[model samples]
Target: MPGFLLHLGATVMCSHGGQATPTAPFARVTVSGQPVTTLAAPYVIAGCGMPPPPAGNGPCVTGQWLVGATRVFAGGLPVLLQSSTSICVPTGTPMQVVVTQLRVSGV
Candidate 1:
């Protein structure tokens, strides 16, 4: 057995208010098809409602998703623990995003 690292990416829109407005939803990165991290989850919004746009700014845009490194076994080999992050942009009005790439490497 061998150990490897995996990478993933995702894109999502940010939601408005608590009504789940269909604009600017939240983006997330996943592993094995599961939401494990997000940009907005770590931060806190001050207002209850959507905040005003920044002065002299266009539509809001988020930075690319990033994963450092994740340790995973090839078959049943035990490997050192590692970590990684995925990145992507959402599509469509409702937005549908998925992990576009997966890479595995041995440490």
Candidate 2:
């Protein structure tokens, strides 16, 4: 499937609603005036309110992209896409790509 490339400015969040930001962006490529992200980078999560302790699994702290554009490469790394799948650490929840550049896409 084809999807828009994910950039630093893209709106991504954990399943629990924590905002996710890529620790590293591929500076070699730009989308919507922002650096594109790759699978090599982990996302830092913030503002998650899942719960705590025995009551629940609690907030997600980080996320790692498990899927990306199979044919798109940035600096020899697979570029992240809007349809890319990710999993949050500890919580083992998936992240959601809410908004991203609508112009550039990859499969």
Candidate 3:
């Protein structure tokens, strides 16, 4: 690894029982640690903003795995960004993360 890392954006619709909670970043989403926190099926990243083609080349934020499946996709918490994840352009840039409701994913 010596180039770039892509993080795909995903639209997670976490619901408690049957009520839809506010959707936020993957880092702000959780499923009570039940039925396994990870999504059962390999969910294709949806509504992501990952760059298309290659880094510093083609369309950016338009790639298939688009959002880039950043570490946030792994944690699925309403917390802070993983050290591995990019802090957007211009590192050390102050960012705001919102803590949504207890994101419950039933699947």
Tens-digit lDDT string for candidate 2 (1-107):
58999999999999888999999999889998999999999999999988878978868999999988899999999999888899998899999999888999999
How much lDDT does each candidate structure score?
Answer: 0.27, 0.92, 0.23
Which candidate gets the maximum TM-score versus the true structure?
2
The local lDDT score (0 to 100) that residue 63 gets in candidate 2 is: 96
Q: Candidate 2, clashing residue pairs? A: none
Q: Which parts of model 2 are misplaced by more than 4 Å?
A: none
Model 3 lDDT tens row, 1-107: 11121112222311111111222224333334322122212222232333434542212111111122223334542222211122222112111212322342211
Query: How many Å off is the CA of 96 in candidate 2?
Result: 0.2
Report how far residue 97 has shifted in candidate 1, in Å: 11
Report the alpha-carbon TM-score of model 3 versus the true structure.
0.20
What is the lDDT ranking, best to worst? 2, 1, 3
Give the number of the best model, judged by lDDT.
2
Q: On lDDT, who's better, 1 or 3?
A: 1
Give the lowest summed-lDDT range of ten residues in model 2. Answer: 49-58
Candidate 1 C-alpha lDDT tens digits along 1-107: 23232222232222322111112222243355633332222212221233334532212233232332234332232222122232222211121222222443343
For each candidate, give its TM-score against the true structure.
0.19, 0.97, 0.20
